[model samples]
Target: MDITRYNSEAWDREVESGNVWTKPVSPELVRKAKAGQWEILLTPAKPVPDDWFPKLEGLRVLCLASGGGQQGPILAAVGARVTVFDNSKKQLEQDIYVAERDQLDIRTVRGEMTNLAVFSDSSFDLIVHPVSNTFVADVLPVWKEAYRVLNPKGTLISGFDNPLLHIFDYEEYEKGILKVSYSIPYSDIESLPKDQLKKQLEAREPLEFGHTLEDQIKGQIDAGFIISGFYEDNSAGKEFLDRYINTFMATKAEKVYVDKCRDLA
Candidate 1:
């Protein structure tokens, strides 16, 4: 199966269904951004810290897999040269819709998150990636590509689900009971029961992969990112896990230059 294509189509339907992430940011928000007042989410709850960002004016920013017209428009309004890359056409359209409505300068590119061949090396100064990586099967390549495309000392801010969120049985979760029926590094495609999988397919929902903290955090480090900031957050809704512990996490990392010849010795 072409996972990227399937998830793209599913997310298009999600946009039609008014999924919160697919909704466009309001024009008023863009206006405020242009006025030097703005905040955006890298996780479900906390807004990204102001210090995590450099001067926005004239900086190249990549909104990696973070379409939905949210982050890209705000950044563009604030004077960043913005490009939003995503797998879903509808998601990309949200960015375009906001850009056109606000007359903001923004570029929208459609592609898989792991493959950033469209961009050249050291092409961006900042990459704002939200919680969308759960849909991708492998995340290390995403980190590698992000590291490659970022200029030295560039920032990478990202959010991801804690894999423990997937260890519970979904039915039990709905009942406010967290039953450990699955292991870490979970995949709805491979781990869910046949009935559950059928239901997800019938509903046209995108499949999810649950990567470990190791894969999510250490992968960035392995990709040559220096971990700088970190935080944990819970889902916004009254979910079972939210009652117990935070189910989401966000990280701020910076790319530092390394001498390849010295490393090869």
Candidate 2:
């Protein structure tokens, strides 16, 4: 099965079902954003720190894998040149709807988040990547591509799930029980039982992966990004775990020129 293709289409169904993330911002929200009264999320709940952002006016920003019409339109409304890139066509349409309705200049692109080849190197000054990396199998590629497309000193603000969330039976989460059923690096394809995987497929659920800290955090460092800021957040709809601990984390990274070693003589 093609996970990327399946997930893409599944998200489209989510849009049709009116999933909260697929909902576009209201005109009032855009108006407020234009007035500089706006906030966006990298994680589930807490708004990103104000200090973590550079000036929004005229910044070349890429809302990488963040196409729910939430962040992109807000950034564009605040004077940032916004491009929303996501795998879901319907998700991108939400951004387009808001952009057209609000008369904001926002570009929407449908593509795999990991393969940012459609964009030129250093094409963006900032990247707002929300908690969508779990949809991809390898997060390192996402980091590498993000690093490639951001300019020197460019910032990449990203949100992702803590691999700790992957260790338990998600079914048990609502029951307020943390049953140890899966490992750190979990996957619906590789980790789920055959029957469970079949059920997931039959239900048209988006398959997911649990990336390690090595891949989620260190991968950015290895990809030439300097980890500068950090914060933890809890999932909004998952209050059972949120009441216990933060299940998500957001990071602020900068792309800077790092010179390679000369030689090993």
- Tell me the TM-score of each prediction against the true structure: 0.97, 0.96
Model 2 RMSD vs true structure: 1.8
Off by over 4 Å in 2: 259-265
RMSD in angstroms, candidate 1?
1.2
- Candidate 2 accuracy as TM-score: 0.96
Backbone clashes for every candidate come to 0, 0
Best by TM-score: 1
Error of 2 at 107 (Å): 0.6
Alpha carbon deviation, residue 95, candidate 2 (Å): 0.3
Q: Estimate, for each residue in 135-233, the C-alpha lDDT of model 2 and write its tens digit.
A: 999899999999999998899999999998888887786588988899978898999888988998998988999999999999999999999999999
Model-by-model lDDT, in order?
0.93, 0.92
Per-residue lDDT of 226 in model 1: 96
Clashing pairs in 1: none
